[model samples]
Target chain A: DQQVKQNSPSLSVQEGRISILNCDYTNSMFDYFLWYKKYPAEGPTFLISISSIKDKNEDGRFTVFLNKSAKHLSLHIVPSQPGDSAVYFCAASRYNAGNNRKLIWGLGTSLAVNP
Target chain B: GAGVSQSPSNKVTEKGKDVELRCDPISGHTALYWYRQSLGQGLEFLIYFQGNSAPDKSGLPSDRFSAERTGGSVSTLTIQRTQQEDSAVYLCASRPPGGGTDEQFFGPGTRLTVL
Candidate 1:
């Protein structure tokens, strides 16, 4: 019953390199996808998001690419910094007329950036 | 300028005791959600509330788990007769009005330890 899945449990990348985090979902009804980064003992911080209408969305150094046909999406952090090291979670949900906007989240990927 | 806040950041209780967790969403946000995260596990959706509409309790695990949003702002989640397996960090998140597709701002989470 796990709809969203993040296959990689941990990832290590060098500073200034590109760090890619991937997520897959089986629920095609989900039209919106989001990524959140979390540090130890802290709430998750918003990262990037993509709507199914488009294939990619970018803000600053982060970009989210979505492939609807494949039911896959990824967050890419270019020139990753040590500050970028954290657990990344992918969540998907559909928006209806009312308050049924429950989110389905992935297991999360722990990314470690080596300086 | 403030973010979502939850009370009793850390709580330790004996098994069979009931525990109530609280969440205060952003001032203008109209959507609120509750999630649970266990060790090495993903965020599990628990419930959702939007404005003055009926709260979505479909994700609630059992009758022992319940939540209420008074005045469409603050929310309280109650777990009755908690079991050892109920130990986990409960997270609360909120989204501003007309921002269903946007990222949710999460609280630091309330960690519950059942002995």
Candidate 2:
């Protein structure tokens, strides 16, 4: 069974609009959540992260909201630019028996911004 | 290097052939991880290394997959007797040692095509 899931395979938004991507997880042990962006032929880059203790975290035009009770999280990009087009992956991290943290990843949502 | 890098950006191998993918993490990073993404699938964890401890290879799919981190820096993932189902993009990520969140830096990845 998938611990983390991104049900939407793709999302499209016009430049200057708001784009929202959603993710869900089944593991209650997950305490840290992160988002990564990837362009074609390039490695994924860290975008933003939120701890389970907080309900929301924001960086400039990007904001991540977590609803712990619902087991859901969403990433919002305001004034979306064409440059924001890429695959967005949501990952959750939890420490295992060895005291080391490992990430559980979602399938990723492909976002396209139209200029 | 400034970022994690993987060698042989792309590889094509015949079924039953063995292939090795290498990763060079940023200097001083003590944690390394291997993951793969098959078409339309999420990133699957294969293995992880931290400092001088034995690697966490619980996520490896089968005996055919193996990885080693030497000197606690560079890592190599080897797939033995590759099969067509083994085709995927292998990614390497590194995490800096600190108290910050569990964000990881990734390499461009090696796209493997098995025929």
Candidate 3:
């Protein structure tokens, strides 16, 4: 069974608008969540992350909100640019004794920012 | 400096043949990971290696899939008796030695096609 899930397969937003991507997890143990962006033919680049202790974290135009009670998280990008178009993946992991916990990933949501 | 890199950016092989994919992580990074993304699927963890420790091979799909990290810097993933179902993009990532909560740096994946 998938421990992490991204319910949307794709999203489209006009440039200068806001874009939101949602993810959910079944594992309550997951305390660290991250978002990654991937362009075609390139590796994924880390975009942002949030710890379970914080309900929200923001960087520039990007903000990540964590709802621990709902086991859900969302990434918001304001003033989305065409360059922001890419596949977004949500990952979650918990701190462990090994300190090398493997991240559980969600099927990515492809976002298109149309200029 | 240099980010993670993978060799044989694309490979096409016949079923039942064996293949080896390579990864060169960033200098001084002590953690390496191998993952695969099948069509329309999330990034599936295959294995992980940390400094001088036994690898975490829990995510490997079958006995046919194996990986080894040498000198804790370079890694090789071997798939024996390849099946058409094994076709996917193989991704490699590395993390610096610190609290394992840091983001991982990834390499452009190797696209494998088993005919």
Candidate 4:
């Protein structure tokens, strides 16, 4: 079963506009959430993360908000750039579970930011 | 050389053949992870290794799949008598000494095609 899900298969946004990507999870035990960006033929690179204790986390133009009650989380990019065009994957994990903290990923969403 | 490195970026083999994929984690990183991604699918966790401790192989699909981390630095994933269903891009990631909270850096991945 897929523990994390990204409903949107693809998204297109204009440059300098805000881009929003959403994710949902089924497991309540997951206390940590992360977003990763990947390019063709390249490994995914870490983008941003949020802890369960906090509802939001921001890094520069990227912000991630989590709603525990709804089991939903989203990543927002302000003034999206063409460089932001890539596939984004949402991952989750629970700490203190030994090596079980390994990440569970979502089917990625391909974001194309048109210039 | 600075980030995680994987060998044989692409591999094409006939059915019933065995293949070995290799990964070299970042220097001094104590945690290593393996994942598989099929076309248009999410990342699937396969195994995890931390220091000299026993690996978490719960995500492995069958007995034909196995992995080992030697000298706590390099890892190898073996798929015996491969099948077409086994074709996918295998990814490896590594985390530093800070444990699960640390962000993981991934390698470019090895794409395997079984025909």
Best by DockQ: 2
Candidate 1: regions farther than 4 A off: A96-99
Q: Model 3 over residues A1-115: C-alpha lDDT tens digits? A: 9999999999999999999999999999998999999998888999999999999999999999999999999999998999999999999988777777678899999999999
User: Per-residue lDDT of A1-113 in model 1, one digit per residue for the tens?
Assistant: 88999999999999999999999999999989999999988889888888899999999999999999999999999989999999999999886666466778999999999
Give DockQ for candidates 1 onward, in order.
0.78, 0.89, 0.81, 0.77
Docking class of 4: medium
- Tens-place lDDT digits, model 3, residues B1-115: 7789999899999999999999999999998999999988779999999899888998999999999998888999999999999999999999889875668999999999999
The estimated TM-scores of all candidates read 0.96, 0.97, 0.97, 0.96
Residue A88 lDDT in model 3?
99
Regions more than 4 Å wrong, model 4: none
lDDT accuracy of residue B98 in candidate 2: 72
Clashes of each: 0, 0, 0, 0
> Candidate 3 or 4, higher TM-score?
3
Summarize candidate 1's per-residue lDDT along B20-114 as a digit string, tens digits: 99999999899899999999888988998888888888889999999999988999999999999999999999998875576799999999999
The TM-score each candidate achieves on chain A is: 0.96, 0.98, 0.97, 0.97
Q: Where does candidate 2 stray beyond 4 Å?
A: none
TM-score of 2: 0.97
Q: Clashing residue pairs, candidate 4?
A: none
A1-115, model 4: which lDDT tens digit per residue?
Answer: 8889999999999999999999999999999999999998999999999999899999999999999999999999998999999999999988755654678899999999999
